[model samples]
Target: MTAPILEIRNLSKAFGPIQALNNVSLIIPRASLTIIAGPDGSGKSTLLKCLLGLVRADAGQIYLKGQLTDKNFEQIRSISAYMSERFSLYPDLTVEENLDFYACIQMVPKDRKDDLKHRLLERTGLESFRFRLAANLSGGLKQKLALATALLSSPEILFLDEPTPGIDPTSRLEFFRLLEELKKEGRTIILTTPYLDEAEKGDEIVFFHRGKIIKQGSLSDLKNQFPLLVFSFEPETNIFEAYTELSKLVGPENLILRGRQLKIFVPEGEELIWRGKLLRLKREEPRLEDIYFYFERRSEMMELGHDQ
Candidate 1:
């Protein structure tokens, strides 16, 4: 892995009675797609905000290119682009006009601004709709425009917060295609996403829960680290009865019902207990969803055990 471009040491934050982030630490390698994956209020957004200086951390330090830094992130901001959760575009402005507005803000040289804008419009497939008003554009187009504006400065590190939700599937696929192209150009991309299925695209994933990081690693590495063996089979009897019976044996946390098929994860040697009752039983590879749930369940159980 390349040397770290962004590093956080013991970061923390709070909002009134809620602890938004707690002693969180992370390392983002240069030119890698690092995903922050978590549910709502899991501190994913807060961590991003802190890095961009939108929200101040109550404690901890942020380092840029291995250099310790103060709260003022102006230096970091100079080399970074951030596309927030909300589409921050001027509804009254045309697509071209919005690009012009952001170009001025990013201080792109007048000599190169027009050429860069033209290329960005073509790249994002917005050239034909350049004259269209922002309010009139579709959700997907608005997101594309937002991305175009963020690239106005040609930032080294791009931070995106849940950019895929609410968009159509085709648009979502296209957006990721664009992201893949960006990654090829050696630009570091950090994004927070709730969609674990699409997370395979990332070089590394940081899973967060309840204001803490549950686990962080590459998909294959995390799967290899998983302790359970996954299995699936079709039950000869009613699926509901099978589900209930299995739930009683191994708990619902270890079981997933897909139509007539039941999938489960159990410790070594435990599969023998239910093997005789199952029909067409097959061993299965652990999926990202299964791995995430395993870590999440373990974290919850540990917390419960600690509280007692």
Candidate 2:
């Protein structure tokens, strides 16, 4: 593995008596798209703030690109671009005007500004609407504009918080296309999102919960860790009622209903494994969502002293 682009060591922070980050430590492999996956209030946003030096840590050290010094703090700050969840765009400003305004703030050179702005607009599918006011843009377009502004300075690292929480399906796909382009250019990215379905899009995932990292690995590894024998069924009866009836036998934790299909978690020692066959199951595959819940349950069980 190449030297870490962002190295966090013993990083801890608190808000009065509430510990936001608990001795959190991790490394962002250079050029890798690392995602800090967790539910809301999981400290993902707080962790990002600490990395940007926007929030001071009570204890710990951060190193950017193998160098660590207070003198280089300002330099390190300039090398990365950070985008928050609620992207701020001037409602009255045209798409092009917003980009130009951000470029000026980032100190983008006059000679290079036109080309950069045009290219970003074209790549983000905003070229046709370049003259449209931001307020008139859709939720997706606003996000793309935010990303475009972040890239205006061409920073090496991009830290984004839940870039696609409430976005439409089409917009989410488009944002990922832009992410793929950035990934190909060897850019380091760290983003936080609650959507487990998006896990496959990242090179590595940091599964976080309650300010703690419960799991860290690639999507495949996480899926493999899911302890369940999945089962799908399409019955002639009420599907929800079937789920409720089966819940008594296999347990509610074992059943996950997705539209017309269901994924049942067969405990290692439970008798539900054979019941799945007797009950007539279909499409059998462990998806990322299943794996996500599996880990979440495991963490909860661990917390509840189910395992020591």
Candidate 3:
């Protein structure tokens, strides 16, 4: 509210006949952990690149600190750290070597270098692997080193592209632990992930679909906007047949199959008969995945997506 740290205005981009991004606008409050979620090829990467000026927008404006200038582009680049889904890390270089080289290039001072390196490695849990060549590390450890390198200069804003996609779940948990530390240090973090369940972790979230923002708000705010409640069912017979039959009563558009069970949104007053037919039905807590899928289906039914 007090002048967003990052402001995007009417951003648009296209790749030939396919529009990679439509007119999109968003504001990232200072020191917020913002998560961007979308299906594959929905323009998540393009949006990040456009915001960072790595990819120019066809028509839009990006303002940082209330200042906009094409000439000082590199200066804006300096205040941010980026790690792509396929991050660039030298396979042959030792983890320590990569950190030292990155620090030197970023002009991190010698007097503070050791302290900074130790802190990052400790935070990312890469301290023991520092002497190991990056190529020799496991997928999860390599990701930690790549993230550590990005943190070398302690940029005020961090941009990541699914940095934990292939890493083990434990490693992904550790990665977010590092981000939690950054949050305490007052760093603004924004990243994109296809995993819908992770959306609940952010202070604010923007949902990207078909190159536009369908929803953006704090998790509680977004969840409150939906007028649906979830009911879970466990079948005594075939789960598939039960789901198939229940799909008719509840409408396939509103059901999400999870394992042998399903989470359904039962419209108010349209529930008695449906509840009577179910072998076992219970009210359940609504997870972020439920919230995301509900809107995605709603958007499809509306035949329109929300953006700027």
Best by lDDT: 1
The full ranking of all candidates by lDDT, starting with the best, is: 1, 3, 2
Clashing pairs in 2: none
Give the best candidate by TM-score: 1
Task: Flag the better candidate by lDDT, 1 or 2.
Answer: 1
> Residues 252-290, candidate 2, lDDT per residue (tens digit)?
667777798667777554444333456656546787767
Superposed model 3: Cα runs more than 4 Å off: 69-72, 234-250, 272-281, 304-308
Q: By descending TM-score, how would the candidates be arranged?
A: 1, 3, 2
Tens-place lDDT digits, model 3, residues 45-120? 9988888778888988878877664434676678888988876788899999989998999899999999999998
- TM accuracy, model 1: 0.92
Off by over 4 Å in 2: 69-73, 231-283, 306-308
Error of 2 at 178 (Å): 1.0
Q: Candidates' lDDT values, in order?
A: 0.88, 0.82, 0.82
Worst 10 residues of 2 by lDDT: 267-276
State each model's C-alpha RMSD to the native: 2.3, 3.7, 3.2
